[model samples]
Target: MENTHGYIPSALLAGGIAGTSVDVALFPLDTVKTRLQSAQGFWKAGGFHGIYSGLGSAALGSAPTAALFFLTYESVKHFAGSETHWSPVVHMCAASSGEVGACLIRVPVEVVKQRAQANRYMSSLQVLKNTVAAEGFSGLYRGYISTVIREIPFSFIQFPVWEYLKKTWSEYQKSEVEPWQSSVCGAIAGCTAAGITTPLDVAKTRIMLAEKDSLLSRGSIRYALTVVHKEKGVRGFFSGILPRMMWISIGGAIFLGVYDKVKKTVSKYYLKKHDHIT
Candidate 1:
């Protein structure tokens, strides 16, 4: 197998493809999950209709966000030097870095997308326009801190689990894992991470969807949790857990699976071309 570590082109292309595939394929589920977690009731969030409300924003952002994430992730892992003893730590650090980079693009896209999904605006363009007009460009990043908080932990759990599962399976099989196997591992890891991080996700959604002058819009993670707890008790923390888990599980399979497949393909092609040149 080719050592695809730190392969910038492969990482960028694969991550972009994977991100677009997962987001586009499972967008409706994401909309459902977002609406479910909205302070606005589901029906008020335009439930069961316009499920693709924010497709434009999501589609535009997915490629860059995912590309930047995998680029950072692979580069970190490559430079860190792979050792079984330090694999989990390496993976966690890499994933955390990846999330931070990805969130630079992701938070703005999410701000527009979620508002559109919640029917607070007519379109992604309208959301962008109104947000910038009223709250300035920074408004597009209203939930930046909350998003990074949610994403870092999710990646912390998911990436290590995914790598461990792949390593174990590869060892058992006496070979590198196939894309499908990687996908299965990703699904399992994603489900676990999604369940554990649902509350953070809910808080992020509320913070992003809050009015500019509202308390939640101030982006206090503590305050967001307090409000949700006040509104729905313990259950509030787990709002949209089912859909979140479902979406991530399925999305993880496709995302990591496709990423492995594309990366492997591109890496092999490069190797072959180099061999021919030599």
Candidate 2:
């Protein structure tokens, strides 16, 4: 993490790579989770249970959304990265801020992707056209608020734990930690955060996947809870929890491993070039 520190552009590139790679690789899992969480469950969602459904939209949005997140996060962290006393707070704030930028791009893509996963639309183009025609441009951002709610805490929980763990590992190892170390830290944090946040995630997905003007379309946390509770009891809120946990846990490894690798490669090249210049 330190090697990757002090560089904003590097973070953008690494974040983009990490975000794109994980989302693309785990997209099938995401599709399955979304389908399972739908009010209709897996059977009612139609199709031949194609796991990779709607991957295009997800991958498209993932790059920029994730890039923006790291760009903002790294930029903020750079200012306070070295401040041990302020490390956790800095990581928390930076991660929270990062999600704001991420959500702008992510929410729309998620809207399209989730709908496609539900078999509401066959193509990304169709999802976009129909969404705009149905709810105008705003329709693309249908679950914007809920996404922030779900994502911000995820970043908050993940980054602090990641930062602390990285610091501890570096101290214990008496050397710069390797990418694999970062991957393990990231996996643990991702699993913990995703597990804790499943309820909010469930709500976010339900609201985003809801049809226009439908009862389920309400984006309020309260609405999501009511629907889940009234319909399937406590279990409804945890419907797709298993698939999601697996996706996130593994996705965390891929994301952090790639992010650290890319960060090292990029930063080393530039630093070496700068040394040659000097």
RMSD for each of the candidates = 1.2, 1.7
Model 1 stretches with alpha carbons more than 4 Å out: none
Q: Write one digit per residue (lDDT tens) for candidate 2, span 54-156.
A: 8889888888988898888888888767467878889899999999888999999999998888884388778888899989999998889988999989988
lDDT of 2: 0.85
TM per prediction: 0.98, 0.95
Candidate 1 C-alpha lDDT tens digits along 1-278? 34763389999999999999999999999999999999987888988899999999999999999999999999998888656599899999999999999999999999999999999448899988989999999999898999999999999999999999999999999999999999999999999999999999999999999988999999999999999999999999999999999999999999999999999998888878878888
Residue pairs clashing in model 2 are none
Best by lDDT: 1
